[model samples]
Target: MSINRQIVLASRPQGEPSADNFRLVESPLAPPEQLADGQVLVRHHFLSLDPYMRGRMSEGKSYAQPQPLNEVMIGGTVGEVIASRHPQYAVGDKVVGMGGWQEYAVVNAAQPGLLRKVDTTHIPLSAYLGAVGMPGVTAWYGLMKICEPRAGGTISVSAASGAVGSAVGQLAKSRGCRVVGFAGGPDKCRYVVEELGFDACIDYRQHATLDSLQAALREAAPQGIDGHFENVGGMVLDAVLLQMNAFGRIAVCGMIAGYNGEPIPLRHPQMILTSRLRVEGFIVSEHMEVWPEALKELGTLVATGRLKYRESVAQGLASAPEAFIGLLKGRNFGKQLVKLI
Candidate 1:
């Protein structure tokens, strides 16, 4: 029997999750005496920590189901196939899928959302969980399919230094769009503008007001924002709404500001009608059909050094909860990953 440590939801969080909400427990893993036809045992390597996990802590109807108390926390991870009863996946294959917060997982090879083997030599294995994975695909399809940015158009992206936002800004820049980014601090803002090639970057935390944001937007995008990649919804969304040009496109990727359970108030709902702005919310999973193509493109960009990515890696599963809370607080600089040896 093998023993594995896993992080489970100990209690439902009232607002922002504290350390008390999670509990790490060790369980003895006994292999099935009779092998299931298509089951495989996986050993997790890198676990993804996303902002969406915050919503899963609360009991409510969301895009994804909430995690029940005492259940292993849900997350995407890159793992290696340790044992396989399935013909499709053999032992020693590196795969990516939803393995939750555990050292080992039993998965069906033919399952709808089972692990998919990837070529890690072309790119780092962790990139599969970030850029070449969900966040990358989210930025790609969200901008192309949802926002439909035109060449030479001006676009604004919030959380500009983050995984998804960074991809959005860089992709827009490569497409000849004037890309403006909104980040928390001066360092992040500088990184976005200098490293990511953004036309301008606003330090939202420094300015801290709608008027200041609008003024910055006017300075960055004098013609007005033709497209906006809305990562942070609350006040930033409200401010961007006022600066949007006619028939502007808005891809609502995430609402990190409101993820802590605070009610986010919208100052202007009429901007949608007046500017004929197209605002749409989407989940990256919804565009699974084009995963192969998106990965190919993003991987090429990363290989050629046109696209860059960063990760805030927390060492060990014990640090996952703290890393998760830090992610919600915007303390992480890029894609947050929990490294498990």
Candidate 2:
């Protein structure tokens, strides 16, 4: 039997998650000959660490149930199929799925929408967990379906250098919209503007107060924001609300500002009513029908060198906890991944 190293949630987080909240354990994997019908075993190469996992960690009433304690932490993974009993998958097939924080996973491949084989000829296999995967579809859904940004309109993105936000900015730019991004530090802001091709990017660190942030947005988006993709809530949302044009569309994705149990009260709630703004919240997982369409466009953009993204990979399964904590605190740049090998 081959031993598999995995990370499990040791306890519910009090505020921000720490190293103590997670535990590492080993489990024995059955050999390929023992696999049941329709089963496939995958050896994960990279594990995706995202903000939504924080919500799943809590026992609160959210869209999904809390992650069971002492169980493998929930996450997206990209890996190769080491063994397969399913007709659709082969032993050497590269796959992407919700394999959690484990080195290997045996999944029932026959289950619909559970596992997907990806082509790494042009797009890297690791990208299946980020730009060409869930985050990319999320950006497409919120920007195209909800915001409905028109050419020449201005679009604003918070947490702009992150996986979803970075994709959102690029997609908005491709649609001929003026893209403005908000990131934590100068380096991320510079990358958003210079590399990610956003029209302008504001470093939220420089503008601590809501007034200052809104003033910066006013200068960056003089035409007024027609649509906004919100990742971080609280002050950032409030600031964007202040500069929004009439009838602007706001897509609420993640409220990472309050992920640590802190309050994220919006300073300006009246803007929605006065400006006739349309604010809608969504969970990308609930909309599986759009995955094919979204992935097609995102894949082309990535393969052709039009859509650009970055990653901050932590080495080994032992590094997952610390890397995840850093991700929640906005410490990691681009997409945060654990290189499990």
Candidate 3:
């Protein structure tokens, strides 16, 4: 139990992530055998694997700094505090914070926004890293704030069965927007429509071409898309652009189609001008002030069963790298998590 095992960034990915990009190692936990002031030791129960981590894996600048070579891969975790030198954090308190890709984290209390307590009595702990956490906040800000979808109006989002996308569609529907989703396959499409209760879902794997995607979008959203949450860029964005209603809003949450280093070109710039559309790219951390309000709503929705989600769980720390690669490949159906304990 004293060995802290972690997955570290070994190299930058050339195209898609592979085994060469990550390496796992173990180090003795608390080698000095003493707790330092302002340090809290947390034993990770679950770690979240998000698309944003992909951006951090690459060398270029984006919203976050790249994952430093030989360092533990960065991720969010829900853990129980085992030792606390900080008065603010008590032993046995459950907290959600950046524990990285390790089983135990000795986190400093001063990192401002990095650590916070969460109540798991009404919600599952893993969910704090998903539906009611960063991804959910991302869905809320990008949809309610940016999209502003109205009742009876059609709204669409890509990767609609994934973490942020699923929440986006559900939130839109709760507001009475006719919701349509773009998922990768027939199974995910079924889950989006039947389980998540979206009005319609497009199996984008079947509609691989831009023309086909336009056809599918037109058929599913016959009223014309009033708002869009853009998780996928490239062909999907271009196709959705053509079907947008005049003055429609697009919240660019993520462009996962190109996250693996491929260049995903957006083809229809003319539509942005012609439709007088509003498009904005957002990072959830940039809008942290809205988290409390957003989490309250999301938590209530989940507790009441009005909001639902699925998960792809990898059972151990050793499985993190492969599971992450699966996530980038759209092999994961919903939120991807690693069980570290």
Question: What's model 3's overall lDDT?
Answer: 0.91
- Runs in model 1 deviating more than 4 A are 32-34
How would you encode candidate 3's per-residue C-alpha lDDT over 49-142 as one tens digit per residue? Answer: 9989999999886888888999999999999989888889988999999989999998887679878988888889999999999899999999
Number of clashing pairs per prediction, in order: 0, 0, 0
Quote each prediction's TM-score: 0.97, 0.99, 0.97
Summing lDDT over every window of 10 consecutive residues in candidate 1, give the lowest-scoring window: 28-37
* Per-model CA lDDT versus the true structure: 0.89, 0.94, 0.91
Please list all clashing residue pairs in model 3, or write none if there are none.
none
RMSD of 1: 1.4
Clashing pairs in 1: none
Given candidate 1, what's the lDDT at residue 170?
Answer: 88
* Model 3 misplaced regions, further than 4 Å: 31-33
Instruction: Give the Cα RMSD of candidate 2.
Output: 0.7
Runs of candidate 2 with Cα error greater than 4 angstroms are none
Give the alpha carbon lDDT tens digit for every residue of 1-341 in model 2.
Answer: 39989999999999988999999999998988999999999999999999999999999889999999999999999999999999999988999999999999999999997899999999999999999999999999999988998999999999999999999999999999999999999999999999999999999999878889889989999999999999999888999898989999999999999998899887889999999999999999999999999999999999999999999999999999999999999999999999998
